[model samples]
Target: MDKFILILANSQSHFINVIRISIFIVMVWIGGLKAFQYEADGIVPFVANSPVMSFFYNKKAPEYTTYKNPEGKTVQNNIDWHKENGTYIFSYGLGTVIVLIGTLTLLGIWFKKIGLIGGLLTFGMSLVTLSFLITTPEVYVPNLGGDFPTPQFGFPYLSGAGRLVLKDVIMLAAGLICASDCAQQIIKSKNSISVNRAKF
Candidate 1:
């Protein structure tokens, strides 16, 4: 058991690298999807409702409520509205940033400085995404009338979108951990250099 514990304890660096790679894969895959019209249209609710992000759109909130393009289906009018709203353009830009961050994070295994930046950026991006839980009404189950007064519809009740956004909390933690690790490596490298100089 002691040996096992020692091995586990020594594996922290390896685990951190694993996390970096995991984040890289997720970011690249999701970001690449942003190039498609379907993915661009899917993010409409969160982006449109965001106070900090809404400026990217040509139209305002509530107006977007009328143009939502649910996955697996598309309407010409909805696509036209989204095109006019700068949805695709913003998505393309955001996607590029995400992919770059992933690449930077993956490079952390060899380049601590770049990895630190990537980790910090990942944290910031996750922070913004998690905020959608607060900014997006679609994150919660709506009180659609049914046979009975839907017992589960409100803030705490997570819809599919809410679940997706909530997962970013994990990403947020991973980013911070990776960033701190990189920063530690940088400081250690500087200290080693200073010590070597003193010995000369």
Candidate 2:
């Protein structure tokens, strides 16, 4: 039993590290996907099939257009969200912010503080996504697919946007784990500092 406990304690760090690394990888990948036009094809289908996302699919949303600068011969960009409703702006703005948060968190340079922020954002998004799934059941089912005509959530069902939805949910879990670990470390460090000060 003593040996078992020792092994478990040692393995805990490894497990935590794995979870943190995975979260970092996921965030980086997502940021890359959005920043660069790489393999973004999946987003459209997933969005179109998702009941929640379908609303935003065919939106003739006005986008930022760029005009060539006469002198610099470079494109001048401007925001045209005025043409679209707040939904588009909110979604776009939140998305960009989330990506930035994830990137900063992944750096591990300011682990505790940034981890907490990332975790909160992830938790909020997860709750929102899950709630949306509950509110819009029809969107849970895919409009096109083979073999599995209907989405089988199995056991404790989860509403997902699509394949990517599951990924996001998993990523969200990773974020929470990272946050918890960071918080624990912060508390431990503060307690240690207090103990040393008392000795002095």
| Best prediction by lDDT | 1
- Across residues 1-200, which tens digit of lDDT does each residue of candidate 1 receive? 99999999999999999999999999999999999999998898999899989999999888988887878999999999999999999999999999999999989999999999999999999999999999999999998866865588888999998999999999999999999999999999999999999999
Candidate 1 residues lying further than 4 Å off, grouped into runs, are: 147-150
Give Cα-based local distance difference scores for all models.
0.94, 0.53
Question: Considering every candidate listed, which one attains the maximal TM-score?
Answer: 1
Q: 70, model 2: CA deviation in Å?
A: 36
Question: Where is model 2 poorest over a 10-residue stretch in terms of lDDT?
Answer: 60-69
lDDT of 2 by residue, 1-200 (tens): 99999998889756766766666666555655543221232233333344655565344212221211232233223112222323333345445765766665564435677767766676666655554444433335533446766656532354343334555677667767777877887899899999999999
RMSD per model, one decimal: 1.3, 8.9
